[model samples]
Target: MQCLYFDQDVTSGTLTIDDPELAGENLFDVSSQRKRYIRNHKYGMVYQNPVKGLRMDFSSISNIAEKQIAAGGRHVGNMQSAGERLLDVVSIPLFRMKEEPRNFSGGMQQRVQIAKALSNDPPILFLDEVTTGLDLSVQAAVIDLIKQIQRDLGISMIVVSHDLAVIRMLADRTLVMLNGRVIESGLTDQILEDPNHAYTQQLVYSLL
Candidate 1:
């Protein structure tokens, strides 16, 4: 994911760049600088914004292959080959292989985000508000794509969405958090039909 921090603080808050736990640890502490901690930390905290989390300079294809290149997937003279292979995997348009990401539409851009996340071959994918601004049709497409990616990749998907429709469609299990605590947790259908916690009830009712 591409994360841009204009006047943003990436530490010590809900961002959880350091720990998978999503809370605790002082940002001022110098120990947070280690690459090992950064790389291996939460695989399920999608940045609050999609555009903030990506590299705008690269094409969708380039972005997808970036992880492989970082891990030395590119041999002496096969960089293009590696890229083309990844493009096929991520479903990027081969015709626009060299276009910058700013040129794509919102849905296309989101697909690039997915491609970039999958590039590292992460076992768990975090999708934070992935469909916030899209219309229903586009939202459905993106949600379906995520499910397809998860199934084909065999990875756990943590989709953080305030939209119940998205949750009901994409989530296998659901967790309801209010005031920063988990108030309810169970299968999506169960939670939708019968929420035990008041916060969950409010949240479910709000969907109506």
Candidate 2:
């Protein structure tokens, strides 16, 4: 919700880095080139659909390497090493580095997408419904992997998901939104167990 660039309905706000405020392009305006630079260098995004975020026909390593390549990486060996290390970081096997993501399982594809997102080593990562379509076991594994990555890298993440389980596992603070407005905001455990808002209470009960 913080990054309203992807939201068509968002109309007002300021996204800033340091002192100069970045007008919500959705509201005010921004140069395309500057937006591209901000997205490429400062923000890493993993979409719900792997195909939307990844090059399905490319090798997993190639998909990850592209980020580095865009960031001015020229050495093949270094790029390949970084790719493999990212794969390992995301719990993907090194052998799959040469394989296309189109052939991987949904869980594996998600992992590859995560690796690609981290390729630039961006300070902020935005994950939009990342575990949406995976099997329950796979969802659990992916969530665990995300938690581990956060612990090891200390990268801040903004995760958007309707799944309460994911919030419980990965979020420290929680916000419950209804009709584009936040109805409740508090510590994850407190929000889940003792929701003050009526809608939030219903959401909690439905999950139980």
Candidate 3:
């Protein structure tokens, strides 16, 4: 993250991933600002690579609780109890709440991400190929979890993926993008069963 003055001048930069920032208030300030933005938006990105994306050092519960804190909700101040509750909500045992994310299995880490996203209590959740790395059983569980969350919170979703099966399962509405343009879009079942565009038809057929 880069810190800039209100006048658009670069004030400082913090690269937490890089070895260059051994000790710096600049990065903390910038990351804080980013966290604030994420909290306000109530949207999250569940990246495809768990190893590369999630904070390996932060306990899964802490990661979720931090977002809740940034969102100005009733979560940050009571982390000890709230964090455990969140892990439970995501189906993680209370024992795992204190463990670092690297200790979790792939599916578990993804659940951690979901729990974290919901911590902010956002009205929408955008999942990018959420089930790509999971086994079939885990994929179904994850999909069911998303549906249940939507029902419970009345949240909307925009699931970005190239997999037709995944889109069919998750999206009420479907959109087909090609070279930056939306080639087809509508009710998911409609797009799947009776596509209007040739590209969409091709896509559906290929899925068969």
Candidate 4:
């Protein structure tokens, strides 16, 4: 569902990248190669499971640096420095740079994945169930980190989660999906407080 908005192979509906280089180009109509390029150069995605988004066996530095390399980075020193800085920003100690994410705690692994996603400085980010399965404190800390990064970088973020608390913290707008369809859409506060659809109302009430 998140992929539909970002030019993944959806069955129908028009999608377009708003960047100057790809101005008004219909994403669904574009060639697959072009779509791949757009995804590689314009967006970042963090999956719910770190394994899906990160190389578990690679050192954290290597995982983060790989994104830069894929985006055309050539200088090893520059890439290494950038990776270390991002890891520091994500609250992972620089001493852990040589360690693989497989050895880190769940929260730490998620942080490494986040660092890797941001390695290319993409304008848009997609997060799918990022806080699921984390301890409450760890989840809160990671959410705060994400919020800070969004504010500092001013990057566009689309977060997908069933957790209302997570949505309330990170989202300005909300789309309440029932099954595969969006049954309600509005500002996050409004959707939570004054839902228009029955499904949305029930969902919100359960949370309360």
- Alpha-carbon TM-score of each model against the true structure: 0.75, 0.89, 0.76, 0.95
**In what order do the candidates fall by TM-score, top score first?**
4, 2, 3, 1
**Number of the top lDDT candidate:** 4
In model 1, state the lDDT of residue 142: 81
Candidate 2 ranges beyond 4 A from true positions: 1-10, 17-28
lDDT (Cα, tens digit) per residue for candidate 1, span 21-120: 4346443342434333334332423444666656778876677566556544656346566566556665677888788888877777777777666655
Better of 2 and 4 by lDDT: 4
Q: Mind giving the per-residue lDDT tens digits that candidate 4 earns over 1-208?
A: 4554343457787777678998987877887777667767788888899998899889999998888987889999999999999999999999989999999999999999899989999998889899999999999999999999988999999899989989999999999888788888989999898988998888789987
Error of 1 at 41 (Å): 9.7
lDDT for 203 in candidate 3 is 81
Error of 3 at 19 (Å): 40
Query: Where in model 3 is the C-alpha error above 4 Å?
Result: 1-41, 73-77
Off by over 4 Å in 1: 1-48, 76-79
Query: Model 2 — TM-score against the truth?
Result: 0.89
RMSD values for the candidates in order, in angstroms, are 5.1, 2.8, 9.5, 1.5
Segments of candidate 4 deviating more than 4 angstroms = 5-8
